[model samples]
Target: MQSDIDPRSLIGRKAFDRDGTKIGTVDEVYLDDATGEPEWAAVRTGLFGRDAFVPLAPSRVEGDALNVPFERALIRNAPDLGVGGHISPEQELQLYRHYGLPLPGPAPDAPGSGEAPGSSGSAA
Candidate 1:
């Protein structure tokens, strides 16, 4: 029995643990590339201000509140995002490697404007 929820309304809502303890607010949501469906939510947690990626499957929206399946202890026990406030680029690469995701290339506007795809743009 799935409930109808407005995605726009969910933005900036408070997230709470199973015990009704405030964990954090929703930072950004990550979606599965193939299906473009929400997979996880980046939750801003801790005093130092870091974001933790939490599984979206175990979460539900009720009016203005987001209920997560785990307790505060469990959430805190999860791995830290590390320096620079969030996970580092190298760490992100490592995570993608661990998950077997294909590494993405630079954007269309990246340096070397007219170079061919996959070409580093130096005379060989």
Candidate 2:
């Protein structure tokens, strides 16, 4: 996500999957409570379709569209956390797990380690 772009601008923009498959239009933008950064977008898949949340970090905005680096089927099947209001930490963690993406915060097992639990803290 472009840091300069206003999160509100993402609303209503068309979103596409990795292979250019049309997924939906962004209905809402979820921001990180800690950093105020754009975190996820709830996209309405179709007319009367349920909103699906897509992470904003790995997604990009091109023209009037959002390009999500994920498969259409996977995104469409994401956990239905509903739209509006706040997303609790537990819900956020679930979203990360659903997308197989890294957690934004430090590893819980090793506080301040800034690395996932099985990492050696050295370059491979």
Candidate 3:
């Protein structure tokens, strides 16, 4: 989450929840298409578990672990946006709502341009 930390290096690291519960391993890092900043991380819950997307803004890296400030169940139940490409604006909003995180930037339906917040595309 810190500017000094490389997003690419986050892959494969272990992630923990607020109560120090082991969630899973970081499977991928999603970068903001507009700012090119690290925005989300897809964690592999288990061998058969699907990858869950976690916000990177509030998450921090300590040593080799990624400390996520949310409950393990919340993280595990995140919307299945799937991995390996950009996260569309609509999908991003669903994630924000699911986490109860305040929406960033302008309102999604703001007039003027057709594109909404995070409409550019996410890089994983």
Candidate 4:
């Protein structure tokens, strides 16, 4: 598993393949809400084109460049965002739906549940 590295430090780092070809630069890191761990990285591909988000796990990070496990076809075929180069709210919703994560709402233990974090609340 990857350690909790600063996302800002990786923003402009080089992304590479197993063969060490220059792919692109890191754009942003997506965090898993439940774990606050990095789940994916948005990488810019193609000169002067839009970027795409690829699933990233801790094991993918190497000494300097990120070692993307999949082939270029998979990266090229991932979801495309416009030149704004950032994942938008709509895209996040789409990902959530695709992954079947519960939409954010009240905490499981609020006034109605009579429980709180660290207060005998049942784990969701």
Candidate 5:
């Protein structure tokens, strides 16, 4: 998985949005409890600079930076998961919901069920 990586490798890397807007720097990485894989990144953001967690699923490390497919406002507006603490499943769910990301795991239907969120499957 692209999300699986040495969390240490991400610290201090610049984070940008899909539109190439610089959001902030990576402050910390949160690991998934079930798999011990890098799941979210705590980014230092905003004028005063508070840490906000952003999902790493669709994110990619490019050169010296990480690019997340989310706007700065969206990450800033996500639930305040805090800069420290072991994120509980409940808290994780809240974060996912706030970001409109689906809960991790298999889809409820087949791939052709039109359940995918960001795809047209194939051009008609």
Candidate 6:
């Protein structure tokens, strides 16, 4: 469910897990290259403030905060791909696998069965 809130507006918002445990502050939001949809968020966590990428599929923007359904521990261990960089497809796959979440994007349910629509399979 996409919230009316712009992902950019989510920056600096505090994020909490389903258990109401404060996870961290949203440092950045990553959008899908194809759809331009908010796909992942880089949350500043840990004592030294590390940025970890968390999937936004199960997250909701509530007022000034983002509510994620995952546990605090899980989010704390999420892959740290840093902030302000292009996330390669391989990196995206790693993130999804790390969280045990089905890979999202074109034909996410079928795993290796699909390519980005209208992006390929054409002859030059």
What would you estimate as the lDDT of candidate 3? 0.87
lDDT of 2 by residue, 1-124 (tens): 8899898898889999999999999988877654577888999999989999898889999999999999999999999987776777667777888999987654357455563322111100
Give the distance in Å from residue 56's predicted Cα in candidate 3 to where it truly belongs.
0.4
Q: For every model shown, what is its TM-score relative to the native structure? A: 0.57, 0.84, 0.89, 0.61, 0.79, 0.81
Ranking by lDDT: 3, 2, 5, 6, 4, 1
Instruction: Write model 5 residue lDDT over 1-124, tens digit each, in one string.
Output: 2744577899889999888999999988877643467878888986697888888888999888899998888988888867666776667777888888876663466454443232211100
lDDT of predicted model 6: 0.74
Cα lDDT of model 3 by residue, 31-113, tens digit: 88766788899999999999999999999999999999999999999999889888988899998888998877744665634
Each prediction's RMSD over C-alphas, in Å, is 10.4, 7.5, 3.1, 8.4, 8.7, 6.4
lDDT of each: 0.56, 0.81, 0.87, 0.57, 0.75, 0.74
TM-score comparison, 2 vs 3, better candidate:
3
Between 1 and 6, whose lDDT is larger?
A: 6
Model 2 / residue 64 / CA error / Å: 0.6
Give the clash total for candidate 3. 0
Q: What is the lDDT of residue 9 in candidate 4?
A: 61
Best by lDDT: 3
Q: List runs of model 2 lying over 4 Å from the truth.
A: 106-124
Candidate 1 error regions (>4 Å): 1-9, 81-124
lDDT tens per residue, model 4, 1-124:
2666776666777887556676688877766544465656777886885576655552267777887765666566666644333345466555444433444443666454442211111111
Global local distance difference test of model 1: 0.56
Ranking 2 against 4 by lDDT, winner: 2
Per-residue lDDT, model 3, residue 82, is 88
Which candidate has the highest TM-score of all?
A: 3
